[model samples]
Target: MHFQVWLQSIQANGRLKVPESEDVWSLLPSFPLSSFSLSSLSLSSPYLLGIGALASLTVYWLVTRPRPMRPPCDLQAQSVAVEGNPSCRRSALLKDDALLEFYYEDTRTVYDIFKRGLRIAGSGPCLGFRKPGQPYQWIPYTEVAAQAQMLGSGLLAKGCQPNPEQFVGIFAQNRPEWVIAELACYTYSMAVVPLYDTLGLEAMVHIFNLAEISLVFCDREEKASSLMDNKVKGAVPTLSCLVLFGDFSGDLLERGKECGVEVLKLQELMDLGRQNLKDPVPPQPQDLAVVCFTSGTTGKPKGAMITHGNIASNTSSVIKILEGSFVIQQEDVSISYLPLAHMFERMIQVSMFCHGARVGFYQGDISLLMDDIKTLKPTFFPVVPRILNRIYDKILGSVTSPLRRTLLHYAVRRKQAELSSGVVRNNSLWDKLVFNRIQASLGGNLRFILTASAPISPVVLSFLRATLGCLIFEGYGQTECTAGCTFSMPGDWTAGHVGAPLPCTVVKLVDIPEMNYYAKNGEGEICIRGHSVFRGYLRDAERTAEALDSDGWLHSGDVGQWLPNGTLRIIDRKKHIFKLSQGEYIAPEKIENIYMRCFPILQVFVHGDSLQSYLIGIVVPDPEVFADWAKERGFVGSLEELCQNPDVKKAVLEDMRAVGKEAGLKSFEQVRDLYLHPEMFSVANGLLTPTLKSRRVDIRRVFQEQISSMYSKSAP
Candidate 1:
């Protein structure tokens, strides 16, 4: 009988001789396959089983195959639509005036920004700091606001009036009190002048007199004592009061009185403010918020009058860029280890607070920075190249055995390949076996690292990115630009470039004919114009005129080139480029950066004269590396003796040659001869700026005799 007729007859008879377990197969009559006539085939036929298996496999393949991922732009759009607030969505589409309008749509001053953040953050930890050997303790945002209000009121009650032309000075390390003091100033529209803790007493006095500071906030009694010194007091005659974040002994207060100054503790000031809690004046967007002093690499430090709008606008732009590039959550944590006086760190602090991210201050000692980082487990870290170099050196030093070193090298190579190919066949296994430990050293939660202030070695950048499995971004800006004007976007991954101009900012390269730099040649001094630019240098009209032109472009004095992708690569400092007798322009800083990457070399200063054909260098060898080299060569003595040893000099020169070649430097640009210097250049030695940039003028002066001798010997 035919299969369909037999099946219908069995169903009608209700007596089909099928077992209960086989009854499920009878349900196949309800499926579309029922139409297929299989009566001619036996139940054990191979073709019937083959066709059924193929159909099942096809369905499994169709269901289990991977789908293509959405593009980054699409993902960003979706993220904004789903997670972002209405303002954020609107701000993303706004441009130029509209963008600025959007940023200022709800907030005008930093006080406004803080209040908005406080509203969202509620009772969350706002500022965090730790006692020695203790976990971090936090002060809530609401408490911070209340304290700042009381402090501002107290300052006003104590005859400290807000003056647009005058300022209050904050000379301290990063602390909760610093933020409270700054916020208090904002509450009363008082401009703050942040003094670098590393600054010499001379520089401190100079800035105090220059900025006409009326009152100063000191981090400790020691700092407060420094201000009470006769010379410091004499230089800044306008100074009338001192506020100490730490306790002051009776002797210290009496000394302050002798210096014609009144000293008060932080809590005492706050109590006074509570008593004077009346209508307080708020700062306008155009009001000056800070008088940030430049590093003074070449001359006296000029205070850049940064306004509320200048920093607020820059902070807003930075937040917008970072939000698009990274996954920033309110729960994100950060460590504030960089000098808070520096614009870079200060701007980051403002940005973090604005985003409601908790910030922890490191202990006063930098040696404990890693411990602090480990404890904080920060999600975002902003650093300078010096910090990165140290971290890289430590990691390299950890692999003492040759076999482990070789394994690490191979693993790093594999990681680079995996990142490049966008494939991870065994990433989880690799992470478990190798990267987890490294990540754990950094608290195992670091997602992004920002490097700026100076150029970093691309090799270091790549290695860090590969090993940490985190995005490393480079940014370029000076204090004049309110910290950042250009920054590498997440996932861009291109080395030696500082990305494009930030939204609401414009960057252009202008010709420097004297140095042979031209925009037409794709290289020139980078000039910037935007709301982020400083208004002008405080009380230095001549310098301000030199920096900012009538057209509103601030001449950066740093040379850069635009890549095909429109990213900016800093080439050299315009003022530092000197032409040789052969008419070849040489940038010592650029060459120095390359050679400094050598493991044995700690610092380098390349010098070339206008009449010279080749360059000479002053090399500072890494003490530990030099000691090892000295021991191997059977030389035993002080660092000075090791530096002067002929064999050590030869080894250094060889390493320099190898590093220079690897950097692809031109022959003339290479260091032909060098003088080994045992001392490391430092700000205290007057050889480096407060920001750690070498003071070329001072270095040249210090090494003038050696430079002359080297040139005299190489004379043709």
Candidate 2:
């Protein structure tokens, strides 16, 4: 009998199929059942038979296994959360799959989404971010969209096209006009290229040259007017159209004309989009949505080609992550304060649109962030670590009297205990006696706090977690990844790790023996592969090839390791590591993080190599704390003087040493000598990125003299 014929025979005979078929049927062809004897099959034979059975079972299990998922909350809740918000609606429309429908199925395109929001919001004012003393105005979404259409039409009339490839530059700060200009650009299927507000003219020229941007939208003539006033004829000869967002009068237009640049009021362009809508709204999602510039820390900025699909996917990933954590419902609210030019905040804004969450725009400037939070009573917060750190510092600084400080610490512990239980007390005697106005001041609706951009200090993390009663999640990704990669679960969080890779996102470590830096166990370069990884760098094939390998893994350029619990820990940038003469490499960020944790210091740059036998640091002491400490001690001096004093130096050094011991650093690695400086490194100073990470090379160069003096043996 043949194997196949015998298997059919076994089935006819009503016995087990797999091994029984093999044993009684297939094996009999070799020997014959008539000659077989069961008595010879002993315990060892049974063990071998059992092993065979287990192997078959394993294969069967493998074939039938269920798929993995980090399940999100009820999908229905996400669909309705941003019901009446224009920005939220735009995000949803961008993210929604044609196969899957949301509650508002008709909402499509940025135009349609805003139109629907207008219908839903009815007569309400669509508040824009404002400057202080500027009267608040509500431009309804209907009017806003109409105005955008008019401006888009005006551009088309001015010889701009409805083509999907033409690029328009939106170079301005966050404001209503910025949004309107973007919407107008979308109406004509023109790609809106975002320029950094703080970029110097040289960098601006590079972008304009590369992008071939003809039409530029800026907030005021004060912005573009300054360029005209400076007699800087932009290298962009093709740059024909310039539109000012705010009210621009005669002199500014005359100034622009002198520079040979034609200027139009933002309102005039918006009116054009409206007039052109009589023919048709020409833009669609298939058109490129934006051209966001990459942060040029390593080289000149290259545009990352962002499509509506890219924006939508990233937005969905964020929404799904939030849905998993917050169970965000229809009434949940969020505040948008971060720069829209950056991917981190842009993707979040898109997510808000998709989820139907109410989004409040901050009234211009981050100093008003707390005020905005209180006014909106937002259920969600998306902030960088610097802001969170400042908040933590303020709370810690408020304890004046020694006895009162002791009592406050105990009260915080008690509050943490109450938080551990599900019951929250806003007006309990214990609460009134303790947390009080601080809790009320934060506006109480702050339930979901999302921190990103840079690694947050563990101290700030723990403090917020203990007090806020909100679940704060840290997300990690790059602009190249379109902001969809990994996020720490509010429930399953570990400080310093950026959670597990997001669902459907594959993560791996590439061993870089040349780099010699490894995870704690043995580090490797972190690589991610997924739908979210960018197609490639725009117009830079060589650079794109360097970043993305043949198999489509994006080499993240970040050194990372898996925590024991399988969370991802980003250690430092590959470019950030430097070697001493001894050939020992040091990761500056790790050492800097330790210093930040050990002291109330805001920023520190640790530098030393062949020039010095050991490391020395330039510390930027926290000004707020230092000032208060000085005032309390009846100390009077300039900010610089306070930082240079011998007493202050001794105190800061002790803090550094205490931090070193706690972190268990080796003698050679610890800071041997350090100098305190009054001024903190900031984005405005070119020492930090908008994300609040120190530009290590820039810092090293700025403090080169201070560093050289510190390492000199006779200098002290």
Candidate 3:
């Protein structure tokens, strides 16, 4: 009776399904239970016992099977308690299916990435550098890796052990040696501390001292000399050696010796490395790879600690997005002109290298950037808005003829319409006649151009897209996120939005109640949490804690709003926004961007205070434009003298009003009074950051008296 009940339970559960044509005894394979023989029992009882025992064994196996192990780096599975809210748990942004696949599959370090690229690109040109009035010199991938290995061996031989805490500094402009030195450091797990070549002496001294950089690689003799100078060397006593990319002069060597530091040439180091080449210590993904300093627009520069995994993960996501949206091919080429010390350029370099793309460095002069662009004919160009503004001004200035200007205007409108309609049936004849020439100026093979660092004017963006006949993508990020957090994809041509967040990067808006920025209103401070976010500010725990919350979100000070299309639109910087006496909030950057589009204005600083009812501006007129205006009006004076002239002041004020109106700025937002300055804000003047962004605090301090006088005079 028990055996019969077991058989009935198995049948009810659908665990056993016998074929209609086959008998139950036949399906049992003539097998018997451990203690019962099939022949000894009746056929029906034998079948029931055999099926019941088989079902029991199957259930036992199912219940006792071992489970598969989970990956150690599964960020989503590791939840942490949020500070002040113990009930809330926060995890890394790994919910996206594509991001999860990438996270699990791509488990390589910076060194590993380089090796993979080398294997694929063997003899292909990896790094190219050109001197003024000379052809470009190309170094293949294999050669770069071999030299990097040798350099790593040489550094180890010279008592430079693999110490992740003690960093090596790369203080130079964009060059081939800069990248090679960076890679060599990775071979021995040394963190690279990149110092912007344009940093002030004091700033440079601060970084060298802060990071405790023992060895520094200098691009030229002058750089080595400047660092080894008596005054600066005293400030950075921790620096022990200098490696010059160029031939080390005896004078520079003597200067280093006087400073109690050793000096060696790059060639000598490479030779030493070749002699000492042996087993190398490879860097791990979690090891500190770089300590990139912020531009210090607000205060003293803070070094952001970026790990090998941070770079690898960010670069991989970037490559995936670019390839998906822009179809980046292995044969694509790029020109490296931006300061590589900035994470933006550095990230691009790594991504290009990862995909086996060739990179050509520009001659160190900005004036020759266009000439180099023409020669290199890069397929991919990453630029700042300043460069784009200059290009637009130069191109528009050249259209002196009315007929040509009219034709160009029509072409731009027609192209814009086609882009909006998304029905590009055929290329317009105007493209072949007018736009093709503009494209040729940018190497003709250009597919897309990337703009970042600041918000670009929509007019300029549209004009460039129409004229060049190439897609324009704007990406938003900071040093904290390894450069890219969000990017505008190909079909995402919204005028003001920065498109969507990159895969694996989760971007959300958080409330800034004091500033009236709220996520509920679709505007707030942009916060990010993901693989790309840096570990923290090196050696600055308080600042790091403030920036990165216990929930692991990096609270970016930038303010943004969500667009209707689910994209991000940067509104204004929370710190840069100031409330006027009338309780009107003004975004100086927005106003500055508007006035900058005016032909006469070269650079402008919009200033306001909570105590003041109106706005005042410091405008720097374009030298050439100002000269032309002065000549046409028969005004006789230097630029400085002309700035004080009422006529010139009135002309600039009128232009500002026109631009502000065109930009749809509110009445309270317009600059009511202004002062013309002949000199432009620059890094040398301590009024601009190395990245060419205005240092607002410094500017306000420097022009304090001028601003006060202007406000006093304008009082009713």
Candidate 4:
């Protein structure tokens, strides 16, 4: 691991991203590298250890940047402080170009990957599901593939065409049947348009007609009946057929006939397909594989047209990137609980399938997810930030006394020290004595956990890494890029930043001058261009044009800053940021994320306008947390009654302010006025989308009077 050998290794094995440390600060978090001693450098740390050439480069980088101490690499919260004018625009590509499709076979389509699995591990346990009181029953890869073929034939037998233009709808929860139905559609060169509960009746009607869905498969009779009702009312005129999984009463068929739609049982459809078997009509790379409708924060959900190439490319990129680090193996098992309708879960599933890994479905109850996890005992765990946050809160909340706190902190520090040195095993006394329960809760076999769909807090990320002793990879992506654009790598202990771009995509940052973000300063709007990028939104050219530039670059609305370690930190969203009257721009989402850590609040919406000088927030408090706070302070009221209490509101606002200050938010960034809403911002309330993201426009319109009142009262 010496310098020249590392230099030879870098030239041979890695494409070293030489940091322009001329303007950026040091690599270490504690102090400036200018004051750092070279003797302290580890020769085998994989940061091209301190040898002659690397040492000279490090010396040049540290000495050239005589800047003040930049903010810590692990951003505490809304801290994105810069100290110097950077000298160059920045972009990051793969550490090695040969990795883009290295582990991946020449799979041009999604079905090709499935076939590869069929060749490699045909007899292996593939999809597994569980009954209420029974163990998981697995369907072998060969059997599952045969079932998909039969179902695809069944789709054709029931007047469903194999044209890519004609989409078959899948409206069901995540299950074996949901996947089989999707794969069936792929088998016939057809596409699937997923229908979810969050879409609402109006949105469902829109999707049914927008995709001109003639036949749909659902798991429940209730969903089938509701969809039939829409068809009967002529709201969804093109919807003529309904397929329900499992058993159903004959009366449903009578109702379907009355509604002019045919209802077929899952077994009945399979029998029909078996009787009328046909050859597979595989799709080309450019053919539409799915029309994934995104649950957006505003307006009707837009359908993102994902091609076979889009999915295959993204899957290949992910597999290749994870090859040497945290590779998915044939023995690996993962529990499928996240929304399968979303590209994020679908991408993960495909990766698992490609490696012949086992995927088990949850029992469909959030409360029993842990029970299901223990039952399945998955080797690989995939999650979101919210899931990790709950684990962090629950673990910390259990420490009731000073002694326990001290012991916990000491254990965490010890584990964290070992973790920084690349040790991630449950071999320590602390792991056996204290963290075993935490690990056991997740079935105790997790080697790695991959989190995406949101940025995880550095504290929570670090805490989970220390306690669980698992390599937790933080990924940043959206549906637009087929779920993953940048994923953190192994051995990178630094937090608050997503890792470098995948070899499938080239990530670049362009200056967003209006927001004071410059690429030369290592800050700007992130733009991605590569095979993994999705095709434009289905039939929505205007938005597609807005997202994809004249060049191939897909302009991510997210603002990113390149870290000294050549990683990207998502700092803000350009579309969501608003400016105050005094000209300081406010990123409401960034502030909201920080404020969400406040105990009393369950959900928060920070609003700022150019006409206003200060910010206002509408928070939906956690009833339990509020009750605890009220009881401790001799206050008396239900959540509704407390919302009207000036004292309660004042206390909540003060708590928010304190949390914001701790997160290092500036005065303007802090909410000056607060409204405690008794009601939750749920999907039913029109404030949240099905995905639980706040619908800002609807929330604003619904609480316009309250917003106006808050601003008026706070006015000078």
Q: Clashes in each model (backbone N, CA, C under 3 Å)?
A: 1, 27, 0, 0
Candidate 3 structure, TM-score to reference: 0.82
Candidate 3 C-alpha lDDT tens digits along 389-415: 877877777786889889889988887
Q: What lDDT tens digits, residue by residue, belong to model 4 across residues 223-260?
A: 89888788778899988888889777887889888878
Instruction: Write candidate 1's Cα lDDT for 454-573 as tens digits.
Output: 999888887777788776779889999888888765445647777766664667787888777887777888888888889999888999999999998899988888665556788888
**Pairs that clash in candidate 3:** none
| Model 3 spans with C-alpha error above 4 angstroms | 1-107, 230-233, 421-428, 624-642, 701-705
In model 1, which runs have C-alpha deviations exceeding 4 angstroms? 1-104, 230-233, 421-427, 581-583, 611-613, 624-641, 683-686, 701-716
lDDT of 3 at 436: 77
Q: What C-alpha lDDT does candidate 2 achieve relative to the native structure?
A: 0.66
Ranking by lDDT: 4, 3, 1, 2
Model 2 Cα lDDT, one tens digit per residue, 1-716: 44345346455875434443343323434423464368867768775455446545654654554322233422122121124421111112124322112224443344445555556555444434544554334565556656777777888887887765788888776776777777777776777888775556776777877878778888766777654543445466667778887788798777667777788877776666556554545555445677778757655777777665555555545544556345654456567778778788766655444444445677766677677677667777888887888778877788778887888778766755544442333444555776666666777767678888877887678667655656677888887776756776434433667775654356666676766654335367877766566777668898889888999888887787655455667776676677776766777777877787753587788887865557888988887787776666666587799888877776677778788788776666687788888887887888876656677667888898887778766533
Task: In model 3, state the lDDT of residue 73.
Answer: 25
**Using Cα atoms with residue i matched to residue i, what is each candidate's TM-score against the true structure?**
0.84, 0.78, 0.82, 0.84
Candidate 2 stretches greater than 4 Å from native: 1-127, 130-137, 227-234, 278-287, 324-332, 414-433, 515-522, 627-638, 713-716
Error of 3 at 129 (Å): 1.4
Question: Candidate 4: which stretches are off by over 4 Å?
Answer: 1-102, 581-583, 622-645, 678-680, 683-686, 701-705
The candidate scoring highest on lDDT is 4
Clashing pairs in 1: 154-273
